[model samples]
Target: MQSLLRWGTERGAKHSCLQVMQDNAPALRLYEKLGYKEVYSYWYRIRPMST
Candidate 1:
């Protein structure tokens, strides 16, 4: 992950963003440890397919 961020920065990226599931505790912890902060929260819903 850090390598990818560095790659983007080398290509002139000013910032980076990541999306993780709300229930993903491990990933959340990792990102937070890496200096990421919670900007906002959102919920997604899926519709069932009709037979």
Candidate 2:
């Protein structure tokens, strides 16, 4: 992932980000260790549009 990101960054990407569910502990840890920081968070709720 780091290699991929570095390649993208070198190719002119300003930044890269990925979304993970709040319950994804392992992924969050890995991302943190790789220099990613929590820049924003969002919440979601879903329901059927029709019965």
Candidate 3:
């Protein structure tokens, strides 16, 4: 992840974002360590299928 961020910065990338589940503790820790923060929250909704 760090390598990819660095690569993007080298190419003049200004910002980045990612999606992760709120309950994913491990990933949350890793992203926090890498300087990521929770800017906003969201969710997805799907319609039920009829048989």
Question: Judged by TM-score, which candidate is best?
Answer: 3
User: How well is each residue in 1-51 modelled by candidate 3, as lDDT tens digits?
Assistant: 999999999999999998999999999999999989999999999999999
Clashing pairs in 2: none
- Model 2 has a clash total of 0
TM values, all candidates: 0.82, 0.74, 0.86
Worst 10 residues of 2 by lDDT: 42-51
Clashes of each: 0, 0, 0
**Candidate 1: Cα lDDT at 3:** 92
lDDT of 1 at 26: 99
Compared with the true structure, model 2 gives a TM-score of 0.74
Worst 10 residues of 3 by lDDT: 42-51
Residue lDDT tens for model 1, 1-51: 899989998999998888999999999999999899989987888899999
Candidates 1 and 2, the one with greater TM-score: 1
Q: Which prediction has more favorable lDDT, 2 or 3?
A: 3
Model 1 Cα RMSD, Å? 1.8
Best by lDDT: 3
Ranking by lDDT: 3, 1, 2
Q: CA shift at 20, candidate 1, in angstroms?
A: 0.8
